[model samples]
Target: MSRAVLVEAPRPTIAAPAAAEETPAQRPSRRWRRAVSPVVLVVAWEAAARTGLLPAEKLPAPADVVAAGWRLTQEGTLGVHLADSVTRAAIGMLIGGVLALALGAAAGLLRLGDDLVDPPVQMARMLPHLGLVPLLIIWVGIGEELKITLVALGAFFPIYFNTYAGIRDIDERLVEAARTCGLGAAARLRHVILPGALPSIFLGLRLAIGAAWLSLVVGEQVNAQTGIGFLMMEARDFSQTDVVLLGLLIYALLGLASDLGLRIVERRVLTWRRGLRAT
Candidate 1:
């Protein structure tokens, strides 16, 4: 008879279940909690105002803001000011966005170019856009050019740096594989590098978009322009807090709308990345 030995293999540890029991709808309820949480806050605000918890002059309820906004819209004042702000922001963002894409793509492709321009880029970025108001007014004579230039500058740097970082950080092995597969420089860039760097570019654009809006508002306040910023300033001079608040609310809503659009674009462009696993 031969003696046989039995060996035991180690059992793999079972990980916690990753798929939550919550349905997709339930998963998104968390977002609503945050979204509608503001409703609760607004209610509390109205209650406090009515109950004399706060001076009515110091704080206006949502109802008052709504009424004020409605009044301004009916009067056509808000529409005119809001259009001015929107136009400046849109034009500046378009110009800066194109330039940033071109510059960032160049910097990403050429290390020498990045080194050459990066220092000046950093210097320009360090100077606050608002701080340049006086200089722009002097150089551009307080015209539309001043405001547009300010917004363009603010919107440029974020996209540039993010794009450069994106291309520089691509997986080395992937590039080597492209080289091994006989991909030319242009083909490798077009096929792999640009696509891989897209997420970073979008991230930069989101930041740039916000900056563009802010810079436009600040620039609008500087000169005799029609804009939300001008509306706010004008309302402030007259102690019309409701109009000022309305202008602010418009800005917030517009920013949200633009960001939502960008998110939609991102979803389409990055469909391959959604819920996908990395190696």
Candidate 2:
């Protein structure tokens, strides 16, 4: 018997199921979760103040702090103090950060540099930079110089240490691969070394910024004429707990602002790391 010719029918292609759309209410957002802690703490604080469990003079309610801050802001005192503090912090961070980057580069890239530079840095880092406030006042005369210098000193070590570690920890195989491709020392460093170490460098930057603020707090105490620390101190003297808390809140806000700025910078610079983001 002759085999019958079979005709094939085209198979249908299946489409992927569409993902469910989340309504505004159902959508998962970080904003609400972020507000949760602050809301809870504020509510608890308010309740405690109202109940007299925590005296207003001692802790002060959130509303009282807000009112105090508003009063100072309107008087322009808070604005001036905030501006001075920000300026000092910015100047100090720049000075310390630049120097640390240079030193870190030397120690990380050159054996001679490492031998000469690392030992002193390691030793100097051991000393409590904050405690040097008294010495700084004596030497720098408790002026802007003292605050800037202290902040610089505080910011320096973290940047240097983290940068050195980051550079040293780069994968050798990548460097070797670049070398095998006839990339010169400078080329290898620019293309391979820096990119690999960027994450750690950003981490150092965040830490350095935080340290700068901490040092500023201490430094501002040394005969500070105008700054957030000064504002807090004046409030403390008058037993204005609300104003003191407001000053602290301002400090926290500044630190938060700086850290957020750095995070944005990190995202821009570390685009290759975008792949690591959750889908």
lDDT of each: 0.83, 0.89
- RMSD score of candidate 2 (Å): 5.3
Q: What does candidate 1's lDDT look like per residue over 217-241, in tens digits?
A: 7887876558888888888898887
By summed lDDT, the worst window of 10 consecutive residues in model 1 runs over 270-279
Cα lDDT, model 2, residue 215: 90
The TM-score, computed over Cα atoms with residue i paired to residue i, of candidate 1 is: 0.91
On lDDT, the candidate that comes out on top is 2
The candidate scoring highest on TM-score is 1
Please write out the lDDT profile of model 2 over residues 62-159, one tens digit for every residue. 98899998999899898899999999999999999999999999999899999999999999898999977778777888789999998899789989
Q: Estimate candidate 1's alpha-carbon lDDT, on a 0 to 1 scale.
A: 0.83
Model 1, residue 237: distance off in Å is 1.0
